[model samples]
Target: MMASCVFSRWKIPYLASMYFRGVMRIPSKESFLCSRVMIPDIECSSSKTMWGFKQYHDGRPRGPLWRGKKLIGKEALFVVLGMKRFKDEEEKLQKFIKSHVLRLLKMDMIAVLTELERQEEVSLAVMMFKVMQKQDWYKPDVYLYKDLIISLARSKKMDEVMQLWESMRKENLFPDSQTYTEVIRGFLKYGSPADAMNIYEDMKNSPDPPEELPFRILLKGLLPFPLLRNKVKQDFEELFPDQNIYDPPEEIFGLR
Candidate 1:
């Protein structure tokens, strides 16, 4: 009886050890599938994706991948130029500007304005200049006024140039000698010698040293009026005594 009891206890342990060994060596197919489901393969995992070696979680996408074409540089300038088609339609033009131009950054807007001036679209450029003035970032930029004024003068839009000049003066932005020369030439070309003389008077009052080119332009333009010509000539001689005034033949002035 003692031997049977000992054998029974020992047999129980031996059988239990064999069963566990067999279970470990040959796992059930169902358990193997369950283990696969519980611990997923990193390669085939759906919750995470590998961008290079870095793991990215499944979340909202970002960066240039989700964004549209960015309007910058030449593209922004092109959009400003496109507004020229709607120039006569005031409401439509404003709507287009509000939609397109108002969104551009400061430099982009300035570039567009400069390109418009270069293209000689005086009317559109003026409108853009006014738009920029109304912006929160706007400052009293003398060069801005100078460029627009030069464009207007080149286009023979002297009336608009005078308006801009007035606006510039109100802001205490004085123009340079080139601006004076262009305005004087524009006025003379358009048969507005009175206005040309007015600009010359303004130039004389300017704090900047007078440039001889403007005096020469005034002398040439003022030939029809000897009094004005002589006044300009006198100032020229005083400012630059070294330079000689070209006395064109009187036939050139139809005075003889």
Candidate 2:
């Protein structure tokens, strides 16, 4: 049981397609002040807000601080409870629990990131990235960087995009094919085919096995640039021998 504190009036601007940004620092202690309070058993299908982790939005002045802290607390408690149930080979299970806790921490961070995106809080999301980068558990991954880049690109923050991309490299985490696909998509949407092609060029050198999805997405994105489309089409065919790659309709190429 937890003690009840002031009913936090914190609210995150509810947004459709929200990408939250948060670096959840789960407490190391087993006990929490929020443990005494009963979290309303509101049912939700969102994996991010499971266990009645509803975002409060009473038009409060405070943005997300109150909600994020409480949610992290609940998640920490859940982790502790989950570990207790894994009773057997106590030593081994303890190791498993530690790893799982890190995963939960990651889930919380991603939840916040996505929520922030949904809210269109790009600045906050960028700040959250900085905070996450400093965390001991933070590991740069392609997917994580993908979403961040997309957000930055939409906001036309090219400098931030380049910095993040460079930081990702310095972390010894090269962009994967999917990351290339997304950055290319962002560039296309930003009306910069040249930048998009630059990513495609780098993607050609990625060591990760060639995937059909990135190629397919890039092909769609390249529809406006016939010359570029042809270039990618040739590479797609060469990389995917078992699959059939189709060109856009003749009408798309302005042919009768």
Assess every candidate by TM-score.
0.70, 0.51
| Regions of model 2 farther than 4 Å from truth | 1-70, 73-115, 132-144, 153-159, 249-251
Error of 1 at 179 (Å): 0.7
lDDT per residue (tens digit) for residues 1-256 in model 1 = 9999999999999999877854454544444554577644223223233442434333334543123224347556466557778888999998999888888788888877877776678899998889889899999988899889989998999999999999999998789999999999999999999999999999999999999999999999888888889988998999999999998887877976
Model 2, position 126: C-alpha lDDT score: 65
Name the best candidate (by TM-score): 1
Tens-place lDDT digits, model 2, residues 105-129: 6666566565556556665566556
Lowest summed lDDT across 10 adjacent residues in model 2 is found at 1-10
lDDT of 1 at 243: 94
The TM-score measured for candidate 1 stands at: 0.70
Query: What are the Cα lDDT values of the candidates?
Result: 0.81, 0.63
